[model samples]
Target: MAIISKLTIISILVISFALAFLAFYLISPLSKEQRKEQIGEIISQLINFVLFLWLAKILLNLQLFVQDPLAVLAYPSNSEAFYLATLFTGVLLFYKRRQKKITGVLLAHSFLQVFLAASFFYEFIQFVWRDNPFSFHYLIVFGVLLALFHLLQGRAKPQNQISIVLAVGAAGFFAINFMLPYLTLFGYIMEPWFLALLLAACFGLLIKDPQDEPHSETH
Candidate 1:
């Protein structure tokens, strides 16, 4: 009975983690139409995920399990932070119908995607190097999330600048984090090579503005 209960608890935790990630992703839409469709789905999934997380945090971490308080605090804290960003992003995107703000949205998506990649990379580095635990955990707090909250208040602005190096870095990060043999189960970023190609394409789209061109818009 004890064994069964522990397994059940762990399973629940993993599921909540996955769902929370989905909620985080749902908040990042490339277009207005996509935002409308995605917003509700994301909100719904996030509510379910947060409820599950709160349950687990109270049960496994706070009340029953009696594990290390530090572990409990750290894990659940990170989990809670998942949607905090989208709160600001969603609000601003909701109010501003201007297509110009898409840059901010795209940048947020890129940075969040980088932070997530860096997180898993930190783990990987620890596994291989055993000495260096490279971390990008707070990138959310100091980086994208903070920037987004400002955007919510109309205080945020995005300059039209995309770096080729940053683009390559994004793609490289995706390949390693999501691709590689035996790692495809995560499949979060698709294949590394594919991600490399993908980042290149995303950069191309930002500058190309296919819809702005007469011939492209006609097609």
Candidate 2:
């Protein structure tokens, strides 16, 4: 049963990654260099998260891991691991962007759009396979936001528009989660931290100069 559960989770993650990749490929309008940089940063973050998860598991079961290093792989992740990974990834991304002299607002705008599209695809799949109404609700919301994003992409500066959309969408998502406690992923309660982060990013983007050219070409 444990092995089966592990394999199921792995399969789901694989499918999600594939869907996210396809979504990013289709929706992004960045130059090759910008795309490459964003993709590399994303992949690095994922790797860092996995490493953090492993470290967390090992620390939690030090004796067991010491006896058998492979045991760490079998350990289930807890909220601690996720929180740590989120913090680590956030700081790492900020540091790397600063080091590279990358504009924070531009990076946030691009990533938020990609994230919304990828999240929509992932939820759509879950809605189809699990028949979850919550997933369907989120899918609709994300789809609408994505449509709005694309519509405004060519006409307006994306930093402000995307930030506003993300802030609004995050508020809506929070409301839905509050009203529907049963909306969960894999029996784990979804945290509102993602929404908080989105709001923070939105505020950050809002303060940036609107006249500055974004890192990527929108058209």
Candidate 3:
């Protein structure tokens, strides 16, 4: 069982990398030098994130590490490590954006595209190899929404397009989990209806235009 679990993890990682690479290739319109620089930045961020994860794991299991440092190396990271890593990465990204080291909108656009592609691939694998009916349904819905977003992107401003894609992706995620009732990373089941409502609110907020705001009436 352990070997099977390890193999599954390896397979998923491989697939995810392949999907992300394919996404970057399809969505990036930058020159060769620009692409190289972007890839380098992404790699650096990933390395930093990995280090943060390791640090988080060590900190979370300080007692175990203190008792047997070698044994700590053999332990798999728990949910706390992942949560800490995510929070740390989010802060890092925010700081970089604030410092003008990265363009927030462009980064969001790139990541959203990659996420959409990766999600499609994940759902495709689940449906085809795992014979999951819900995954197949999710694939169809997600694929159609993503296709529509891409088709309409050229018609809108770049920022608006990014927001549309993100909103759609969020909606797709909510819809899929609502239909399937998947557990959270911490192994707790989330309320599907609550998630659906939350995503719906986000969708509405994203689609709301600043220019559409009502003007104050003068006496």
Candidate 4:
């Protein structure tokens, strides 16, 4: 049963990844140099998420991993806003229809807008409520990185495949870090698993073949 399940999962990832890669190749406007620039911003957002957003999630779930435990019930409310904003940005892509416009907005907003809000709130809470540590830090870092992610993605300079891979890996690391904080209990990948997740997201991106038409802001 375990073997069967593993095979099923592997097959799904393979197929999905292939499609994503194809999509990227198809939609990309720039053949090579320009393409790199376009993807740079997305890569930044991916990396920022790893460093900031995921870090917050990991902290939220820290009780499961460490000694200090907080009320789990409130976590959902905290997480909900993040997920909703993420989803909203994603959905905006499809509604956009225009590849460049959609890509520009998708990469830009996802990486920046939400982060700006978080940053403001972070400072506010820190000042008002006193040192909660977890909330303030998470929001501050997440906001800054999120903005940086957008900025990086929108960079004029081109990014190489290796850099892209590293960015993705960093993004993936936080994803797994947030998802499986206590993998030690289950014999999870002890080593730096961010790279691994980046690899997987890379594969997934390739399979899905997301938009590739090297996008920049419309105006």
Best by TM-score: 2
**Backbone clash pairs in model 1 (N, Cα, C under 3 Å; residues 3+ apart or in different chains), count:** 1
Over 1-219, each residue of candidate 2 has an lDDT whose tens digit, in order, gives 988967766776667766766667667788767776766666666788788767776777789888998866677877666656666666776676657565666666667666676667677777887676777777777888888788877677766677668766876677677777643433345578754763685576456544445756554
Model 3 has how many clashing residue pairs? 0
lDDT for 120 in candidate 3 is 71
Residue-level lDDT tens digits of model 4 in 104-211: 433433323333343444444443554534344344444544445445544532223323434643564455457544321011223444335434433443222344
TM-scores, each model vs. reference: 0.28, 0.78, 0.71, 0.29
Go through the candidates in order and give each one's C-alpha lDDT: 0.40, 0.68, 0.62, 0.41
Ranking under lDDT, best-scoring first? 2, 3, 4, 1
Worst 10 residues of 4 by lDDT: 181-190
As a whole number from 0 to 100, the lDDT of residue 211 in candidate 4 is 47
Candidate 3 C-alpha error for residue 161, in Å: 1.8
Q: Candidate 3: minimum summed lDDT over ten consecutive residues — where?
A: 210-219
- What global local distance difference test value does model 1 have? 0.40
Q: Give the least accurate 10-residue stretch of model 1, judged by summed lDDT.
A: 210-219
Candidate 4: segments with Cα more than 4 A from true spot? 1-89, 99-117, 127-130, 143-219
Q: Say which prediction, candidate 1 or candidate 2, comes out ahead on lDDT.
A: 2
Compose the digit string of candidate 3's lDDT tens values, residues 1-219. Answer: 876866775586559657766667656665555555555666667678778888888998899999998777667666567667766876787678667677555555555555566667776777788676766766776687668657865576555776676567566666666567572322223455544554554344344334432221212
TM-score head-to-head 1 vs 2, winner:
2
Q: Which ranges in model 2 have alpha carbons more than 4 Å from their true place?
A: 59-72, 182-188, 205-213
